[model samples]
Target: MDYFATVLISSLSSASILLIATLGLAVVFGLMGVINLAHGEFIMMGAYSALTATQLGIPFILAIPVAVLVTMVFGALVEIIIIRRLYGRLFDTMLATWGLSLALYQGAVLIFGSVSPGIGMPQINFNVGDYTLAAYPIFMILVAAVMLAGIYALLTRTVYGMKARAAIQVPDMARAIGIDSARTNTLTFAIGCGLAGFAGAILLPIVPATPSMGFAFVIKAFLTVVIAGPVTLAGSALAAIGVGTGASVVASFMTSVAGDLFFFILTVVLLRLYPLGVSAKWRIKL
Candidate 1:
């Protein structure tokens, strides 16, 4: 029973971390229909921003918003300059963003060097039936839950949410209704990048800030969003929980390689079963 409980809590913690990492991509690729290859770089940028702020004597907690703001502003500029022209051109957007990603990666390498220092993880731990567990991972579960709820509320209840949805779903109608679709789209994109920034900032203690760090996360993040299908947020949550928890559980009992194998195999089966995505047929707004 103790072993089982330990595995369960650890698995849930892994799932929560995955969920947090994937949320920004869900908003961007899922809602905006933009395949932002640079998404991972945005996350890297956030991590570096927070790290720099902390090094400059800013409290770690307060640095999170600073990272978000930096990324959001940069995202808006990218949308205005590059993404705006590439809308509806799938391959073009991918190529452009890919180039942007390379640029950002190289820039990071130049500025921060290949390897940079990592922030210390808060030393908080608890006993779980004789098995010690870090409190921060458990805290991630709550953070994931709150982030999910906050995003849902933001996109469903707010006027901005309604406008953003309208702009994405029916741009013609949205424009006809006197809504500035272009402006809404830019804001939506910025918000997505901001969310990515938030993820980097929050996960800094665990993941660290490195030039190549984005590569470690971007693929998995993209897969989670892709498997989420049409209902980006909810579907992503479900996918993260299913895949992340399953992998973590397997890793706890076996080798980490086995866990990765399970993750890939499960992803293949899911894609084969739901070609359009698990939430493709869901009759929901978000």
Candidate 2:
């Protein structure tokens, strides 16, 4: 029973990263209808940023916000330079963003080298007893909780969110009402990418700071993102956390790879049974 408890607790921490990481994708899909394959690149960039900050002698806590800021700036620049042009063409957007992802990855190789960087554990984990509880992972979960709550408040209480939702519901009407669709969408994408950056930074110690680390999580994220409905942030969050925890629990009893494969297969089967996603009926006002 203690073993089970340990796995469950650990799984919550793993799920926390996925929840925070994929929430950005959900926002972009919900607000702008843009399928950005480069979202994962934002995550990679952030991880690289954290690695850079640490190498420069910065503390992890301080380096985190810096990493997030750098990533957001990068994301905004990508929006202005590449993503903006492919506004209405999803296939173009996907292809272009993917191309950009490749470029960013190659650029990372040039700048940081292909070798992965290591992030240190927090000081508190030295006293975790036999529980295997990593302080950093617990800290990550707290940050994710704060972010999730903040997003809820924004979506429900802010004017910007309302306008974004309005644009999503009726773009033509939203434009007629003086909302700049282009500007709104750019911000939306940047926000999504920014969150990815934050997620990546939080994961600095949990995973390797390799250019490819983001790639692994991105595939896992996409599986849950689409399964959560290309829209619906909450759905994505729930699915991400759920899968994260589920995978961990399964892995405790089985091989890591097998656990992941089982979860992936389970997700596909769930999708087939409910093609519209977990909360599609509730979110889509038909």
Candidate 3:
């Protein structure tokens, strides 16, 4: 019973982490229909921004918003300059963002060197039956829950959310209704990047800031979003939990490589089964 409880909690924590990392990409790809290949670099930028803030004597908690603001502003600029021209052009957007990712990666390497220091994990622990567990990981479950709720509320209850959905779904109608689709899109993109920033800052203790750190997360994040389909937020939550927990459980009994293998195999099977994605036929508004 103790072992089972331990595995369950650990697996949930892993799922929460994956959800946190993938939320931004899901928003960008699912709603905007823009495949942001530079999504990972935005996350890396957030990590570095938070790291720099902490180094400059800002409290770690406060550094989170700082990172978010930095990334949002940068994201807005990118949307205006590059993304604006590439909307609805799938391959072009991908190629442009891919180039942007390379540039950001190289810039990070130049500025921070090949590697950077990692923030120490907060020393919080608790007893789970006979097994010891880190409270931080459990805290992530709460964070994921809160983040998910916040995003849902933001998208469902707010005027901005209405506009964003309108702009994405029917741009001509949105414009006819006196909505500034261009501005809304830029803000939406910025918000997505800000969410990515939040993930980096929040996960800093577990995953360090590095020039190459984005590469470690980007692929998995993309897969989670792709598997999510049209219902970006809720679908991503489901996919992340399912895949992340399953892989974590496998790793507990076997090896980390095996866990990755399970993740890929599961993804392939899920894709084959639901070519349009698991939630493609869902009747929800999100």
Candidate 4:
């Protein structure tokens, strides 16, 4: 029973983490149809932003807002300067974002040196039978729930959400109706990037921030988002649960590396079966 509890907790924690990481990417991809190769770099930027804010004497909790604000502004700039022109051009946008990813990685290495710093984990733990679980995972579960609720609320009950949906489904008609697709796209992208930044800040204590760290997160996040289907938070959450649980179970049976391999395999198989994603028919009217 204890072992089962441990596995369940581990799976839930992993799901929460993946959900946070993929939420922003899903939004951007679903709305803009732009595969942002630089999405992970925004996460890396968030970790660095936390570091800088803490150095400037900001509280750790407060640094999250600062990181999010900074990342959102940066995302807006990127949209205006680079992504704006490349809209609707998939290959071109991918190449451009790939270059931007490399540039951000190199810039981080140059500025922060090769290895970067990490925040200390919170000193809290709980005992479940003989197994002790870290408090961080519980906190993450809460954060994920709140974020999901927040996203749902934003989409279902806001003018921006309505405009964004309109821009996505029928940009020409929306534009004719006075909905500025450009502005909507920029805001949507910024929000997505901001979510990525928030995930990075949340992860800072768990993983060391490094230039190349984004690669791992980007792979996991992108796969999760893809499997979930674009633009659907419910789909993303369900996919995260499945992927995270499968990976955790594999890890328990073998090794972490094996778990990652299993995750990749599962992703490929699922994609082959459901090319449009598991949530293809259940798309929320955003």
TM-score of each: 0.98, 0.92, 0.98, 0.96
Model 3 per-residue lDDT tens digits across residues 1-286: 9999999899999999999989988888877988898998999999999999999999999999999999999999999999999999999999999999999999999999988899898999999788999888789999999998998899899999999999989999999999999999999999999999999899998899998888888899988988888888989999999999999999999998999999999999999998888899999987
In candidate 3, where is summed lDDT lowest over 10 consecutive residues? 24-33
Query: Candidate 2 — which pairs collide?
Result: none
**Model 4 lDDT tens row, 1-286:** 8877887887788778888888888788755677999999999998899878987999989999998999999999999999999988999999999999999999999999888667789989998889998999768888998998998789778998888888877889999999998999899899999998998888788866888878978888888878877546787788888887789778877899998998999999999998988888874663
lDDT of 2 by residue, 28-140 (tens): 66446777887777888888888889889998888889887887777788888987887789899989888988988888888878887587666676333465566877777
Q: Which ten residues in a row are the worst by lDDT in model 1? A: 211-220
The runs of at least 3 residues in candidate 3 whose Cα sits more than 4 Å from the true structure, single-residue gaps closed, are: none
lDDT of 1 by residue, 1-286 (tens): 9889989998999889889888988999989999999999999999999999999999999999999999999999999999989989999999999999999999999999998898989999999788898888889999999999999999999999999999999999999999999999999999999988998899999999998888877888888888889999999999999998999899989988998889888999999999989999999877
The local distance difference test score of each candidate is 0.92, 0.77, 0.92, 0.86
Better of 1 and 4 by TM-score: 1
**How well does candidate 4 match the true structure, expressed as C-alpha RMSD?**
1.3
Better of 1 and 4 by lDDT: 1
TM-score of 1: 0.98
Query: Over 4 Å off in model 1, which ranges?
Result: none
